[model samples]
Structure formats: structure tokens, C-alpha cells
Target: MRSGGLKRLGLVSGLLAGALALSACSTVGGDQPQQAGQDGGQNASLATKLIMGTPNPPPLSEPVDTQIKRDCPPVDVLDGAAAFRAYATPGSADPFDIRYQASIADTARECSSLGVEAAIRVGVTGRVILGPKGSPGSFRLPLRIAVVDEKGVPVYSRMHPIDVTVPAGQTQADFPHIEDGVVVPIPANRFRGWKIMVGYDPSGATQTRASRAR
Candidate 1:
């Protein structure tokens, strides 16, 4: 009986020792990066690019083959055009008549030169706030994106209607608006006060909707 008990104890000890050795090999310092990766961090980097409103720029280590002599102008939201008030009654000026208000929160743009013309992608980040008469639902916000010269003349303009969906329990909704491939003649100098403008244009949205209705 004593011999059989000792033989069983020896077998158990061997198994435990092998398990410890295998575990130590798996946890070696050299394999830390691989072992810790939850699959990999590549998806996280991609998500960061979306939040940044553009693709990741080339790494500094990678030399540029050709550099375009151009610049991206600053984006602006004008005071009068930044906000739009939606009222229950058309053409109503009463404060109590406001159903909701949509406004621009931020803007960004990127520029690339295509030989003669510069291609730009402008982005507008905005929010819709609930007013006295507003309720949680979907809303269409009219966005006007334009490139204006120093004299406030629009060199290029485009109308973009963004959909904002506020959840059933939410009082507001945030939306991202991007207008891509806006081509313009390359300016002689980037600092010539060219402006990328974005704003709420209810008239433009209304006209588009009216046309669709017809």
C-alpha cells in the first residue's frame, strides 16, 4: 500500500513540474508584445484616423517622393449663418415659435494639389439642439460649404444636407459632414486669405426638398 501511494505522488509531481515549465516559456519577456496584443492595435489606429477626420499622414521615416506646394486654408463659420432656427410657423420671428436650432460646432479641411487645381476635402462637425417645441427624432440640417476669396466672393460652393438622428431619450444629436473633391485653381500663395466656409443654410435644404417633392 505504501509503495503504491509513493508512485502516485511521483506522477502528480512530474505533471505539475511540466506545467510550470510550459507556462514560463509562454510568458517569456521576448514574447510580451505578441502575448499582450488583443489580436492587434491596428484597428485602434484606424479608429483614431476617423476621429481625426482624415487618413493617417505618412510617417516621417518615409520620405515624400513629391511634395505639392500648396496649403489648406482655415475653415470658418460666420456669425449670422452659423445657426438656423426651425419654427413651427413659417417665417415666424417669435421666440416661442422655435422648434429646434442647428449650429456648427467645428470645421476641418485637407488640401492636395492635382497639378493645376487643388483638391480639397472639407469637414463640418455640428450639433442639433432641442428647443421649446423640439422632440427627439430625425432632422435634416442644411450645410453650405464654400471656398471664398479675400473679397468674400465664392470661388467654389457646394450644398450638403446632413441627417441628424436624435435617439428617443436624447435632446440633441451630433453629426459629421464631409464634402469631398472640391477642386479649385491653385492659388499663387497659400496665405492670400482664402477661406473655407461652412454654415447652416435652411433655404438651400428647403429648395432641394421642394424640388424632390415635385
Candidate 2:
């Protein structure tokens, strides 16, 4: 009877020890820290791009005299017969806040009998916030400009990238303003009408939703 009791006591003690060892191993493994991610597992920053305008193309098959009259109208003709210019703005009064000034010149001297120059001026200005309404962080934005014909075809394009940072839970109302202009010269004796298109990367990565300067 005494020997049987001793064997039973030893088995019970051994089972308890094994259970404690397994629990300890599990606790250690479960508590191990994981590797940090690139963003430190934090939320990503907000990004956006400005939208540009559509391209205005020159009139086709119009008589030289008529084409000149329409493009280099007498109202804003810089030169009596050789050159003309105009201006346009591409943004409104909401979330998408920006403007642009552009110029187009008619360089044809033989077609108009008078030297004519056509120019379009655009003015672009705006502000953008990078972080969430309350939490702010680093961000990247891209801007682009393009020249298109009346048929909505791209003739010339240019892009510029900008990087910015904002403070946490603060509104970034003030931003860098853009006051850039483009000049296009029409070849001599050419009678073509053209339009300029300005656009920005809406995805904050690529250009989208191109708009025309008014």
C-alpha cells in the first residue's frame, strides 16, 4: 500500500511540472515583438493633383483673312497684322483651387499680309492640405501643363513635382502659389488655331481630368 501511494504521488507531480513548462513556452512565444513596417504601421498620408484644361485648336480651312480676323481679333490684337495674344483661367471656387495664364502667338507674316502675333495668358493659384483633418504627415503632389488643339488632342505637355509636409491636427491653408506662363509662337505664313490644356495628377500620382482655360 505505501509503495503504490508513492508511485501515484510522483506521477501527479510530473504532470503538473509538464503543464507549467508548456504554459511558459507559449507565453514567451506569444509575447515576442514583430518587425516594424515602412510606415511604422501608421496611416498613410493624403495625396492629390491639380486638374488641367483642354487644348483649343486652330480653325481649319478658314480663309487666311477670316482666320486672322477670328484669332487676332481687332479687340486685343497686340500687332496690327502680325501678332495677337489672350489670357485664360482654369479653376473655380471650391476644393479644386487653382488658376493659370497662357499666351499664343501667330507668327505667320505672309498669310495675314500684316505681321500677326496671338497670345494666351493663364494664371494658376491654390492651396492643398496633405494630412488627415486632424493628423498630418509628409506627402507628394505632381503638377502638369499641356497644349491641345480644339479637337482635344495633346500637342505639348510639361510636368512638375512638388513635395510638402503638414503638422498634426492642423489646417494647411497657406501654400506655395504658381505664377508661371507659357509662350507659343506660330510659324510664319501658317493659319492655324490652337488651344492649351492644363491638368494635374488627380490620383496624386498621374495626370487626370484635364480642363481648358477660360
Candidate topping lDDT? 1
Cα lDDT tens digits, model 2, 1-214, are 0111111111121110011110101001110001111233121110001001111112223344655434521111122211111112233333223221111111111113244444433322223333222225544444454555445455555664544444566444222313234434444434244443333444333332232122
- List runs of model 1 lying over 4 Å from the truth: 1-70
The clash count of every prediction, one per candidate, is 0, 52
Pick out the ten consecutive residues of candidate 1 with the lowest summed lDDT: 17-26
lDDT of 1 by residue, 78-195 (tens): 5578777788787888878877787654445556667777777665544577778888888777788889987888999878877777679877765555577688987676537887
**Model 1: what TM-score?**
0.67
Q: How good is model 2 by TM-score?
A: 0.33
Highest TM-score: give the candidate number: 1
lDDT against the true structure, each candidate: 0.55, 0.27
lDDT of 2 at 41: 16
RMSD, candidate 2, Å: 30.6
